[model samples]
Target: MRSKEIVIRDVEKTFQTRGGAVQALSKVNLNIEPLSFVSVVGPSGCGKSTLMNLLAGLDTPTGGVIEIGGERVSGAQEGNAVVFQRDLLLEWRTVIANILLPFELHGVTWLDRKDRTTNRQLAEDLLRMVGLEGFGDKYPFELSGGMRQRVSICRALIQRPTLLMMDEPFGALDALTREQMMYDLLRLYDQYKCTVVFITHSIEEAVFLSDRVLVMSERPGSVVRDIKIQLERPRNLSTRMDARFLDCVKEIRGVFQSQGVLAEV
Candidate 1:
């Protein structure tokens, strides 16, 4: 599962708008080790998601190259899955069916009986992993916001992707639900051990779940700091109150303050 090494070299992106070209990223370089959890944080409109899109193969860099597993990224490839803020579940589909949708989209069907059976079993296991075991027969409308995101996470994991790109996956939930989801996500990360590149605005959230937090500059965003989280793993709600966690939060906040991005926080 830790077979891929993400190498982003001298990446740049310029988007064409009605006014003129808007340079979003410039001379960005990143090297994500295999099986590491990395979070990206910066001000609004600072190309954080733009960088993620490039890594996910949804958009191309105007310059430089991105390589995963030592292969140049030309388009969306297997072993890469994305989860956004929204659940994006099929309302008509049952919970298990929604989780199984990826297999169908990838063209797995009854013809490959063995693979299909194995994947079905894996789906059930993932549902249990995310604490949604008995809800498989339920529909998305029947579940709460947190439960829906849990299904979304299970759907992403069903692909067995080596790299999981998440853009604010829990941004929509309330505070309590969001806190619960964070712990649940850590459990999933411990089990899966895949490389994760997460984008978020919450400094505390980034510090809680990440092995390293990459901070970007303002507009035309570039990596300003890559701070390693010193807190031990198997972290929980109590970990947030630790002295080191508070220190890490303050350190990242200082970077933002220097950039005049403190007004938003």
Candidate 2:
């Protein structure tokens, strides 16, 4: 088997809220293999976002360990990139500039690297890959919600990260746009073969994008089920109509139903 890209062992997190100590995560254990697409789904306030934060090393766990690429993560590493719910693009920078922001912020002088020219080409290529090629000269405000989010995705990939951590990256778009972005993201994943840990609340989105769907429980969130998605690759809108696709959706819905999260609708 391929080596694990990310490993979380018996992890626990607690917060000292105004109400007192609130348990956020308890005994969370997961091993994500290299280049696998994994989606995490759960009810609201289930610490799903917190889990992403932990993996990004933005926050430390109250207990337990997190290892990425065989090294213990103490802080954000270049190997990993995160795209949040919001685009979080700098308004002052142009599209290409925004995409190169990470390298710039890290004081990585592009001129010094042997692959500097190739890296610059890759940045432009990524923007194009997300369908933002011609708009590289435009500002973030000049773009629409979906467009800006696409730029964010390009920025995240410019680093050529080994792992991508996405927390509802497409949550703000319209239904049609969300579906398009899902396929776009899957295309990028296939091309780069990068490990992805996506956090989303949409059951259909989760089933469509993941190699495995991890169903999480409410507060003090814990994994309730880890369902493998055996669907064929290059999945698109048509895949949603497949019987196997519906089965996967129903299985996830059943988990949510058991937790009283899914209502008859």
Candidate 3:
């Protein structure tokens, strides 16, 4: 099946703090095209993660509606998958076992590493897709931060979810590792063709990996600018240096600066 379209209309989220009701997002509306790579970039407290949680159905919106493939997002759907900054891998499980964990939750009859199930094959294929072909037997403790994240990516994709929501998945990696991981993610995204909504604070990373970039305002986070990245796809690390890419990054940062969320260096 193809990726599902996402429609979010007039979404609002508020939290009841001891001080008062703190509104995180207000009057937000979005329509995400199917199979597109989109990224949301904003200031630290701009409710980017909150919006993702609502879209993923992990939390309910205070107002407005979120729909995926014409179905209202009332709760977690099998067609939807989410990846957070943390890998959340099971320390006791091997790499392949971690990938198959989602399948095991669905109560697939055959989940054993020794079993030759199609599910296991899919898990193995995903690991190989991310260039971890021979790391299946290694435990998460034995892998580097980036390798562990790759395993988590494989785990998220093992079921072939149509809508993949990732919240700062590579935030913790070092500069070189993060750059390589971004490349790896783009490669997997091309092959999987899933509709991805990525939330990040890095403007350049947003421009490099996204087909369209959404810039949000601070506090009451709403998309203030929907910038289309015109850079040629199959983007590599060098794409970051392209003139158009830099322009997009600058434009996003400018928006933040205008909002007082960022300032001159």
Candidate 4:
């Protein structure tokens, strides 16, 4: 049940807001295996994003320790990449440049001010993987919403990160775009097999992409359920229509309703 790729032990986080102290997470504990896709779901403001920030090392826990691959996550730890709801693309950079930016920042090509040969190839491969082939010269401003997000994902993947954490990365797209992105994401994920911790509000999305789904309670949040998804791999559009897939979605929704995070309609 535990693989030690990620370990969150008795974690707690508190913020001192203008209205005094506010607890975002409490006594959270988890163990994530390497190369597994896990999704976290809960109602809005249930500390889902807070938990992600903690794991990504953007913020430290007020208490407890979080270890990624045996190293404590005390600060912005290296070897992990995160994709948020916003694409966070640089408007001036070409799509290829944006994807290769991480290597550039690492001094692979910084001082020379020239893109490294190998880095450029890796960036190109990633672009092709996401079906953005031959569009590497395009700027972020030239792209549609989903295309921009695809570039963001390429940027994240170019690093070959030890962990990939995505927080509602497709939340802004139209329904059709979101579904297409999900399918593309899973294909890339299969090829890379990096450990993934995804955060989303949609139960169907969680069920579709995850090997396990973590359900959190309301604010001062902690995971209340860790539901394993029994659906087959390489999921397709038909997977959504499968009875087993629907059952997984329904089961996660049941957890939300039971926690009073949602009301029966």
Which candidate number has the best lDDT?
Answer: 1
The runs of at least 3 residues in candidate 3 whose Cα sits more than 4 Å from the true structure, single-residue gaps closed, are 111-116
| TM-score, structure 3 vs. true | 0.96
User: In candidate 1, residue 15 scores what lDDT?
Assistant: 100
Give the alpha carbon lDDT tens digit for every residue of 131-238 in model 1. 888898898999999999999999999888899999988889999998888899999999888999999988999999999999999989999999999889899878
TM-score, one value per model: 0.95, 0.94, 0.96, 0.95
What is candidate 2's lDDT per residue for 1-265, written digit by digit as tens? 2234789999999999999999999999999888889999998899999999999999999999999878888888777899999999999999888988888888668677855566667788998888877888899999999999999998898877788999999889999999999999999998887889999999999999999999999998999999999998999879999999999999999998988887787
Predicted candidate 1: what Cα RMSD to the true structure? Answer: 1.6
Model 2: how far residue 85 lies from native, Å: 0.2
User: Candidate 3 on 101-216: residue-level lDDT in tens?
Assistant: 88778866564545546777788888888888889899999999999999998988887889899999999989888888889999999888899999999998899999999999
User: 2 or 3, which is superior by TM-score?
Assistant: 3
lDDT of each: 0.92, 0.90, 0.90, 0.90
Clashing pairs in 3: none
Residue 146's lDDT within candidate 3 is 91
Worst 10 residues of 4 by lDDT: 109-118
Error of 1 at 104 (Å): 1.3
